[model samples]
Target: MTMELCYNPAAGERGLGDLYLPEHPEHAPVALTIHGGGWSAQDKSSFCGVSQFIASLGWAVFNINYRLTTIAPWPACGDDCLMAAKFLLDGEVPEFAGLDRCKLLICGGSAGGHLALMTGLRLPPNRVAGIISISGIDELTSDFALHSFRYEPFFGGEPTEEKQTEANPLQYLRPDSPPVLLTHWDNDQVVPVESARRFRDRGRALGCRVDYYEYSTEDEGHGIWIPDSKPHRLYPHLETELTRFIESVRPENPPCPTK
Candidate 1:
């Protein structure tokens, strides 16, 4: 495996990303991993483990860092994610030139999960293949979501109802929206499992494909990073499900485009 540093100077100094490109990258699928820190803290390193796991599967992975609430607020984090995806899709980086655009997938936990949804929803249909959100917030309008605390710092104050509606990915589902894989722990103390359930239900209602997996609180816990968390025992299961879903959605032998 080889690694390269990718940054969008236009996005800002903090708008940096690390790309993990595997050998023999012909027609390789890609996974973009985002870290979760309530949108105020944490960095790309938080997802290093998962990124490496995905790359080990003969796929390219891009783990990215974006502006935190302390530096810029609300849409800044969301915008940075979109910029990172755009950077990859535009073939701005040589290391990722072998990526299969039609097989691109976005995966993240916690706050990163939220950004993945927003990014997937906002981007053009042809840009992304699927989404994997672990304990992500679906309804910004609910106080149980990031807007209660994590979101306030970014917004500079409370987001208006309209603004909340705009930020909520659950409210914008369409047939064109990418297929989603949602995994939520029943006992997640931060973001409730109901959020994931709502997203799954709504997506299905809109004729969008959504795969829902719910784990028990006693087994999985809230955060996948927690020590001895259920994630440890379930990593293999989760990865298998994710891989199957990706394979099911991606075209067989879809010729990868090179810049």
Candidate 2:
């Protein structure tokens, strides 16, 4: 079942989310799925298919919408994501009362992926089980020139060196960071593949568990998990790998067990 509710009622529509509940949802792990549109476009509807897929795996999925850069820039989008995650973890909404708060996982694509990394890393330690970033930017300053059009709007203009560092997900890496799954197509033109490689290497160097997958083919490009003609279809092995990662990161002493 799917229910649409406002996580932050003050923000109205932008704070709304579509929560997909699993068949036996009591104590089921929850996954927060964010949509990718360079942080300025798209909505939770863009992630409906992926959310349903996660729900099929027995995870209650909450696909959310955040204020676009057009309406608010810089930290606005990131704040919304963090608020959404907190809403779920705190059991603020009765519909999600019995879900497993300790095992919440965050997943997103492209710009959404960047937000996922930022949100998961910034949240209280051990609050997030894992993070999945697909074709997400790692360092904001490195590729600013190439993506100035998108980055400028999101950052409210050319970002200063300090602002860039603050926005870069790589800067938040630590030994206790939640395990991450990063996937990128080598031929990606939007967010270069090198960013993922760098993040994985840095995370591993810091003793953080980071599982990465690189699609060598050109066909997959940016959104490998979301096919154009087949929106519901996920790239081969994507589901298996995601399932494996989620299982590996399950909290040792969960708040409760599945009903």
Candidate 3:
């Protein structure tokens, strides 16, 4: 689709953008991809494999990025997401023209995983068909929050237990939100598996479809659950599982007639 960078006057930052569309496309569904770095680091370029893999599957994909804590924090990432979603849904780029008025699948891992859930929650209901969160956080203000005290200064003062609930992804849940796929390793040193568990519990409470899995071994490390050298089956297993979960969702959400 589109790969460009422009200075965002509103945010006063240069954001990286990448979009991949199906060949011979007039219109096609899309998935928004986010990368994780504890909100302090990471970029969209690192997602080339995931984006290309998705494009090969006949769906459009976007590897979106935003300013980091070193650049801008909290709402900066959120703002970047809002802008990207608006841009794609309006078909501002030719490659994404088909995704206008269409549904999307949002996904990410680790810090990226947190971003995926938060970004989707900030959008309209079912605006995202599904979410793939890999070892993500449920609450931004928790003691076990990935960033520890790092994000607190950004959030302003100490994050209390009461606020923890509100800061949590579960607090944002509604019955109408889309389905989700949650994955994690039994032992992730960076992001704890409990984070995924908490988020899944919230989604289930809301009656959303949640497909969660845990790798029995730790060969894949924190952000990568499927090792490339081990076997060909890992990638296919993920691709197949996610595709099946997302394909079942229908885009019945009321579309903006004029957009």
Candidate 4:
């Protein structure tokens, strides 16, 4: 495996990411991995382990860092995600030369998830195979999304119907939207699981393929939805489910000649 830091000059220094490429990259897919930190707290390093794990599965992973709310506001973070996708889709990044652009997937948890959804929703039809959201906020008007102190600044003052609907991924669902997989912890103290369910229902109603996975920690004493948490017994299962969803949505490619 090889890793390299790439910066998007247009986005400034904060718009940087670590690209991980597999040794044998022929016909490999790529995934844009975002980190969760309420849109202002974490950087690309937060998803290093997750990116590495995905890279190990024959994927070229771009773990990105976007300008936090402290630097900008609403649309800034999501715009950065779209910019990063454009950077890869431009075919100028050498480390991702072997990636199958048509098979790209966007994934993240929490704030990253919201960004992923925004990016995927705005992307050209069929550009991305799928999107994965873990504990993501689908409805910006939800109680948690409204009361969470971490969101006030990101949304730029008090939440309004217009702004809330604009950021709500559920409002963007379309029949042509890329397939999406959402995983949320049933016992989550943060974002409610109902958001995921409602989003999934809305997507399905729109004739889109939507997969929803909910996990509980009653037996384990705590929610184990996020990967890399202590007692990672559920990590493998979560990853497997994500991998399967991604592969299922990907378009099969013809055999590539040996290097």
Candidate 5:
């Protein structure tokens, strides 16, 4: 199927900018892609090439742009992420036969990964299909408390307690959470290794299907660097795995539905 390309139509260029979609006109599962820029920077189109690549894999891809902190603030960005997902899946979005409600996935890196995990916690277990978090920040609340936190300013100098609870996926555990694939490079310096460990442990404890891939540190640090470029890398494998996940949960032929 071909990928459909469209703007928010409703938001036009006001809500966010340079968002893209695939042209496929069928319910072939959907993946809402978010890009990481420490919450302040980075545009949706920066990851549109990746979204287009995912679209070629027999799935629908929606490149969504949330209100960046540079232009807005913390909760505004987070709320926009949730709002974007709501818009996509509610039949208002014309892409993929109204959001491909049957199969939905959220895949992102770094800050985007944090958003993906947090979004999963807020929504119903079945609202999404699975998560692929590549070097995402899982311990945002803890990081905020630490003096060395890199996203301090972006969070508007420490998000309030309520926002912390909402933004930190580690705060709540859901039993039926969809399968999650987390990738981390142990030696990286930026978003620590503990982030992945905590997420894996909590997810397993909650009875969620969690698979973690740790990359070698021969190269790669601070961000998703060379580790994401291996011959059999997490970044490339995400699309294939996502398709299997979708086929398994296709309602008429759904996988057992997690726990």
Candidate 6:
């Protein structure tokens, strides 16, 4: 079953999400999926199919729409995602009862991917089971000029070095950070693949588990969605990877080593 509910009353419709429940939702794991649109466009609807697919895996999926950068700015979109995750974790909603709060997994693509990392990393240690970032912007400081158009508005115009560092996910890497599954195409024209590589290497050096999949194909670019055929399809493989990662991070499994 699917239900639309508001996560943040203050934000109203922008904070609403579609919750997809599994057949036997009792004690089922929960997954929060965020949509990508350079942090400016798109909404929770963009992840409708993806949420349903995750739900089919016997997981409750909450696909959320956050405040766009055009309307708010840096931290607004990230804050909305964090609030949505907290809503599920708090277990106040009747539909979320019996769901596994300790096994919450967050996933997103492009800008949403960046927000996912930011939201999950900012939470208390071990709160997030895992994070899946697809073509996410890892380091905002490295190539600011190339994406100034997007970053400027996201940071509320002319981002200073401090703001870039503050927004960079790589800066949040800690030994206790939730395990991350990062995937990106080598030749992504939007967000450079180097950012992903840097994040993976830095995270690994900090003893954080970062599983990275780098696609070197020419067909796929910045926005690569799982099971989508338009740009390039990584259907079964992506699905399988997601399943395996979620399984590894379940509450029954030991917490990933921080050191």
Candidate that scores best on TM-score: 2
Query: lDDT by residue for model 6 over 1-259, one digit each (tens)?
Result: 9999899888878989999999988877788998888899988877777687778888889999999987899889988999999988774888877777775789888888898899888888667888988788876755475767677888888788888889989988899898999988888888888878989999999999999888665455563554445322345656677778767876552322321
List model 5 lDDT by residue over 1-259, tens digit each: 3334333444444255332344543545667777877776776755665566666665566667776776666776667667766655554444334335554677777788888777766667777777767678876644565524555555667556776666677775678777787877777566777888888988898788888777664555443432534222334444455456545544333323222
For residue 115, what is the lDDT in candidate 5? Answer: 81
> What TM-score number comes out for model 5?
0.78
> Which residue pairs in candidate 5 collide?
3-22, 3-23, 4-21, 4-22, 4-23, 4-24, 248-255
TM-score list, all predictions? 0.89, 0.93, 0.82, 0.89, 0.78, 0.91
1-259, model 1: which lDDT tens digit per residue? Answer: 6465656676565688878776657778777888888888988877777777677767778889988888888788898888887776665566766567565688887888899998888888666778888788865555345437565675878766777787888877898788889987778878877888888888998899899888764444354554654322236656677777767666347654433
Candidate 3 residue 81 C-alpha distance from true site, Å: 1.2
| Stretches of model 1 off by over 4 angstroms after superposition | 10-13, 143-147, 219-223, 226-234, 256-259
What is candidate 3's CA lDDT for residue 179? 78
lDDT of 6 at 59: 81
lDDT of 5 at 24: 48
* Residue ranges of candidate 3 with Cα displaced over 4 Å: 5-14, 139-147, 153-157, 160-166, 223-235, 250-259
Stretches > 4 Å off in candidate 6:
143-145, 226-234, 253-259
Query: What C-alpha lDDT, on a 0 to 100 scale, does residue 158 get in candidate 5?
Result: 59
* Model 2 ranges with Cα > 4 A deviation: 220-232, 253-259
lDDT, candidates in the order shown: 0.75, 0.83, 0.65, 0.76, 0.63, 0.81
lDDT by residue (1-259, candidate 2, tens digit) is 9999899887789999999999989878888999998888988887787788888888889999999998999899999999998888875568978778776789988898899999999987578889998778865654575766676788898777788888999999989898899988888888988788889889999999899988776464474654563455566577777778777876665565422
Cα miss at 136, model 1 (Å)? 0.9
Q: C-alpha displacement of 170 in model 3, angstroms?
A: 1.2
**Model with the higher TM-score, candidate 3 or 6:** 6
